[model samples]
Target: MRISMWVVATFLLAAVSLEAQARALTQNQQSVCRWGSDIAAGAQASKLSGVSLYGARKKLQVRKFPRPWMRMTALGITEQTYNSASRLKPAAVKQTYYEQCVRHELARR
Candidate 1:
């Protein structure tokens, strides 16, 4: 009886933890999506001004937005990084990678 109770308690705890993790992951994903969108917008603006990916990355560094935002922005600066890894390769490949990375981060969240 005691063993059965322990097992039940453990299962409940595990279930609760899983729920918390899922919620946290959702929040992280949303945050990433927002940040990625912001970074992409910024990159697009830079591109209009004839800024290269390397230059854009430097510009984003100067802005220093925030975590995930900053990271995503930096990620948006490297065209090669996006081309090598991302399967989708959106027109704005750098920005797409930034967004995908955000999504990936969320999935792991």
Candidate 2:
């Protein structure tokens, strides 16, 4: 009985691990993740160019360069811009955005 229980537990654990590994982002999810990364980069660019967060947002809107996910990411970056301390780095922000977008996409699926 003990051996059988151990075998079943191992099998269930392996199945769960395989299912997680098998999951991959779809094209749409990839696009959203890319957009999120882009938004974060854009924030860094705006900072480097001496543009305010509001100005950067306006430029993006005028160019119509971002999707909904990008807009959301940008908004978060903009909020960070106002805070003098604890300002998020562009790469860190990008990673966060990408993860969130991927998770949201996965949940939708």
Candidate 3:
């Protein structure tokens, strides 16, 4: 019974970790979509983490507008951005581009 409990706890921890990672990735995706080159450039120049920037944006969003539906809008924007940019290559490539772009932007700052 102890072993079973341990296994269950381990599984729960893994699930939670995966969920948090997914949330972070989704937030980054939304930020990339909404601000695109601008945010990426800023992040790169400022030497800031993309996830941190996204968190700041989220805080600003809640302070200015308390609508929960904004999350849906972010999702929609990410989808559109992905669809439009993925025409020439895979989505992963575009994601990498944005990540690198952020780094470049941060470097400048």
Best by lDDT: 2
TM-score of each: 0.41, 0.54, 0.26
lDDT of 2 at 103: 66
lDDT of each: 0.56, 0.65, 0.46
- What is the C-alpha lDDT profile of model 2 across 11-96, one tens digit per residue? 89976754463357766668767776776666765676678867877776666543455555567765564343435667766666
Query: Across residues 23-109, which tens digit of lDDT does each residue of candidate 3 receive?
Result: 455465546443553333333332223234355445435543344655455444443443342333334444555555445444555
Ranking by lDDT: 2, 1, 3
User: Per-residue lDDT for 19-95 in model 1, tens only?
Assistant: 45445565756566555555555555555556767776765566655565466545644444423433332346544
Q: Give the runs in model 1 whose Cα sits over 4 Å from its true position.
A: 1-25, 77-109
Model 2: residues with Cα > 4 Å off, grouped in runs: 1-23, 44-50, 66-86
Clashing pairs in 3: 44-102, 44-105, 44-106, 44-107, 45-105, 45-106, 46-106, 47-106
Between candidates 2 and 3, name the one with more favorable lDDT.
2
- Whole-model alpha-carbon lDDT for candidate 2: 0.65
Better of 1 and 2 by TM-score: 2
